[model samples]
Target: MAETLLQDPRTKYPVPPFPKQHQDVPGRQSAMQPVPDCGEDSYVGSGKLTGRRAVITGGDSGIGRAVAIAYAREGADVLISYLDEHDDAESTAQIVRDAGRRCVLVSGDIQEQVHCQAIVQRAVDELGGVDILVNNAAFQMSHKDLQDFSAQELERTFRTNVFATFFLTQAAAPHMAPGSSVINTASINADKPNATLVAYAATKGALQNLTGGLAQLLAEKGIRVNCVAPGPVWTPLIPSTMDAEKASKFGEQVPFKRPAQPAELAAAYVMLASEGASYMSGATVAVTGGVPLI
Candidate 1:
């Protein structure tokens, strides 16, 4: 019998010290160094999500983009909500379309309750109905001191990370029938908070709590709610939010000694949205590269 080949996780993707780089807020995936691998050509689908309609925020890049690609390949039509990353969103849309799935693009700030509600409505109006909601959008900034964080910055982080999740869930829940899934993109910071990322960590903690509560609340309705707590992932958010030095050495603290490519995070989202996870809810699936989540 022939033995199957195995790939080592540590050596699967690029490692640090990566080239120091930076981008403004809501970074473009096209501009990242080495760019993130979103499984554009790698993921294979088996119709796990056939006939399902999905709404994914921040679908233009990073983990969201990877999920969009995976979901589309899995036979799900997707609606991507982004904050003015036109080029990135269009690229993702094209990938989905090429996969023979309808990809609707909506660009705006999810921080607003109205906008979050609008995203769900758009999904219902265009994609038929919402069967999966991936609350993958987020905002963060590193500050050496709490005092260094302006009130506006703090508010923006919470509004973008926490408030938007709440708004989108509330709006989408009505449109979602039984067997639907709500997947939130929490972070390892929820369990192991980073001092420099105090506000972002807080929001992630809130997401975990929200996931647990919503899972129980929606159980009777047959809608599962869960979260993915990823460690350092090589996404546009890294260079745009962290300092150059930190960005260069990103994910070094993890046992893997390297950040995860966005593609690495897609499978979790796909499983959670699939029937395989029908009995799983309120669970925080940690993809922390061997970093245990307390």
Candidate 2:
């Protein structure tokens, strides 16, 4: 048998000449041109999370789908919450099922407190108890000037990206026992604000703060809370939310000169949720393709 070449984790894909593309809000994975890699064929699990139950918001596609796949392979049953993306959600569920785990799909706008509570309840009822909660769903739009930012946009962004995190975490934490984990998805924008993405960046900053505070607050309960701050990642959100020019140059500022693939982020999340990271909390792990969060 021919030996399969393993890519050096630091240097795999070269800088891509991203083509101009666009999709409506909450874009579909199928519509993406390069079909953002979600580790469907690459990731191999070693039973790190065996028999655990997890709730992942935005689990329909992109980073959320990648995390669901990784967790399932690591021996977890997943309850996915997405916002009316039936086709995308179904595909993710199929991947989880294929990995020999229970996969539950819930569709709703998580901005509402009722829906957030329902999502957690569903996880308890369907998967038994929540061991890991990934608050990954988000909303973003780009504008050239601060003047273009609207009051309506600010409210909508905060409700989806910030409020939902609080609601879901509150709902899921009670059912979570000692050694349970919560992983929030922050962004590079939290550290280095993008003028055009001010609203989105602000939400990410809020998420980071929440992750830190919750880690301290939940310490007595033996629950760990952390955040993943990714730099430019080539996900459905890129083409859908960014302009053609911005999309093409997305990750160029990073030393790697390219955006990260969704698969590239799975390891950090897996570590945060596993027993290996029991002592890790209130930390922001940056997977920014060499862009320093510090």
Candidate 3:
């Protein structure tokens, strides 16, 4: 994996790629012509989450995959809740195991409360307890006009984006003690506001709020809550979720003229989850490629 010019196939390092990557469906990470660079070799870990357990939704690919690797390196056993992306989930689990920690893959939709509860219980039963929870799974579709967005699309987007966050956090929060962390994946579009992804962007706004309220609600328990608002990132979501033209021009408008790699965003997750960020909560880390206006 290291022999070739390890890049995200978008642009220069630390800046992200311009053209988006991935498909609109459950895109296969390994099938990507030029896979996203997840900063495995460069990611350094401290014993922050040693002996801890983490439950990360969407841990199968993209930023979730990178975060799982980082968490394993930092000494946390991870349980992943994801859609049926079997190969990607297995591959990520292998990386976590190789990093010398246990990786439990929990496949299901967070749209269901039952599934959310079961996922938390499985993490506790399999990994001992849940110390960290990251609500990172999401889905989106593009539409030129508001009327073009079907009711089904709006419901599905919100169900996965905002509703899932609330349900999973509700389940995991009880199991988490002091020093536990919850990181929600917000989006730059929440602040910047994109016209194309109206419903999806709106859901992100709710997620940002969820982060804030959860931080306060969990403060009494000594658990910290925060968010990572990434800009145009080159992840499987791009290819699978965007139209062909949109996918090809994924990150053209960013000041850096590129999209962020899933690996680049992984560090933010590690920072928030680890003890080094003990005092931080309810804050958003803007990882957009210098979207100056946003």
Candidate 4:
């Protein structure tokens, strides 16, 4: 189904113009004009996750791709899941391997429980047990009115953004041991909802609470669970979900007034999954561009 992504260019609204150019969500790092700063050239590893294996959902590009690169840099092999951005996913895998780590790519929809289990199993079989799990795959659509939202679309949104986390976490739990880490991707919308993306905002809110609940549930098992709530960062999902105008103007609302690169958030994932965050759990690390939630 992911292969079908970006097929229907006939969206609810018109794609607007950006200051320069823009790529859609599930964007391609290669195609970006200046290119997205993914820190591949200088992310030297210190063996933080030496001998570890990880599975990063949505690892083809954006924040997910950055995390995959970071994990590889930290001495861990990686398994990247995606709907289809085949070339982008392969490019990421190549980078991981070039970093002297292994990488696996699995393409499919996470909506089905079977697909989730298969992904986990394949990771286990191919890369060994998963020591780090990053639930970063997500999608959002802008709708002027809730009545305009389709039932199918809403279900798909929740299935991919929310249920995928549940299904993957469930599958990964068996293989994870003490000191294993699970990081979920929350968003700025959780605390400050964007009226145009109510469905996405709601799922993110649920995701934040879910992260908290999972933290408590997994603590007894010695697995650390946490979340990263990133404010307006530029990703392909932007252009793909929103119109062209919104894509280029992204992050203009945040305090920083500029979109963050996925690489900017990589350190957080590395810290949470590595030795740096041994005692940290259940906390949602805010990486938003100065959007404070009290």
Each prediction's whole-model lDDT (CA):
0.95, 0.92, 0.86, 0.85
Candidate of highest lDDT: 1
Worst 10 residues of 1 by lDDT: 25-34
- Compute each candidate's TM-score over C-alphas: 0.99, 0.96, 0.92, 0.91
Model 3, 157-182: lDDT tens digits are 99999988999899988899899999
Tell me the RMSD of model 3 versus the true structure.
3.9
Candidate 2's TM-score: 0.96
Candidate 4 local lDDT, 267-293, one digit each (tens): 899999987899999999999867797
The best candidate in terms of TM-score: 1
User: Model 2: clashing residue pairs?
Assistant: none
Off by over 4 Å in 2: 1-11
Write down the lDDT that model 3 would get. 0.86
Q: Could you tell which candidate, 1 or 2, scores higher by TM-score?
A: 1
Q: Give one digit per residue, the lDDT tens place, for model 1 in 1-294.
A: 889788999989998999999999878899888899999979999999999999999999999999999999999999999999999999999999999999999999998999998899999889899999999999999999879999999999999999999999999999889999999999999999999999999999999999999999999889999999999999999999998899999999889999999999999999999999999999999999999886
Cα deviation in Å at residue 55, candidate 2? 0.5
Better of 1 and 3 by TM-score: 1
Give stretches of model 4 more than 4 Å off. 1-27
